[model samples]
Target: MNPILDAFWYILPAYFANSSPVVLGGGTPIDMGKKWRDGRRIFGDGKTWRGFFGGLAVGTSIGVVQHLILPSYYGSLRIAVEVAFLLSLGTLIGDLIGSFIKRRLNLPRGYPAVGLDQWGFLISALCFAYPVRTIPTGEVLFLLVVTPIIHWLANVFAYKMKWKSVPW
Candidate 1:
């Protein structure tokens, strides 16, 4: 397989998990409208139960589909699903952490923190899946360099489509 395609395919589930939330998330903020000791919203309205779970579902489903379609390429279905689950879980965890830090810094929901917004999910996804299945150093580096650019393009596209209020 081409290295670029392989790396992209490996990270596809995490990408879907990270992006699904934006398109399918809303209602019942995960923090439940509570404020932290600093009198700021815990995770704000951006982090919601629906989005989190929805992302998990979407990402896992992508893995399942991949397993069904490409078992030989991805080892076993169990392994495929497991890695996808970890990546999806890690992506959301990282996003939540980023959002929490943003809230603490008084950055609004739509406000972009360059590194946090761009790399947090990808880094977290890699961390989670790395133990389960070690990615080649080259692939990891490829993802690290490409993700932010992809993220930027995706955000700009979303903004142009009016799905997002601002382009990051």
Candidate 2:
């Protein structure tokens, strides 16, 4: 099996986990409309419990399907599910963290933050994936380089489709 292909396969959960929230967002903000000490919304309206859990479910479900249908490639059910959960969870956490940091910097919701927006979730997802699944060095490098472009392109597509407020 090609290691780069495996890396791409491994990060799918994180990819979906990061993107699903945009489509599945709204409702009560995770911060519940509270203001932080700095007079900023904790996570803003964009970060909602619905989007968070929904993204996790969507990403993990994709991983489960991949594991079930392609066991040889994805590995055992337990490991796949576990890693999927970790990756999904990590992805969401990373997004939340990014939002928090951006809020601290007074960046409004949907505003682009360059590297933080592009690589944060992927980095967090990789952190979770490292313990349970071994990603080849080449594949990790591949993901690091390709994911940002994919992220940017996806955002552009979403912006064109009116699903997102910004092109970034």
Judged by lDDT against the true structure, how good is candidate 2? Answer: 0.88
Query: Which 10-residue window of candidate 1 scores lowest in summed lDDT?
Result: 66-75
Give per-candidate clash totals: 0, 0
Please give, for residues 72-116, the per-residue lDDT of candidate 1 as tens digits. Answer: 767998898899999999999999999999999999888989899
Candidate 2: which stretches are off by over 4 Å? none
lDDT, model 1: 0.91
Q: List the residue pairs that clash in candidate 1.
A: none
Candidate 2 per-residue lDDT, tens place, 1-168, comes to: 677778778898899999998899788899999988999988898999999999999999988988987898755888888889899999999999999999999998889898898789988988977798858777888988998899999999989989898898
TM-score, every prediction: 0.95, 0.95
Q: TM-score for candidate 1, please give it.
A: 0.95
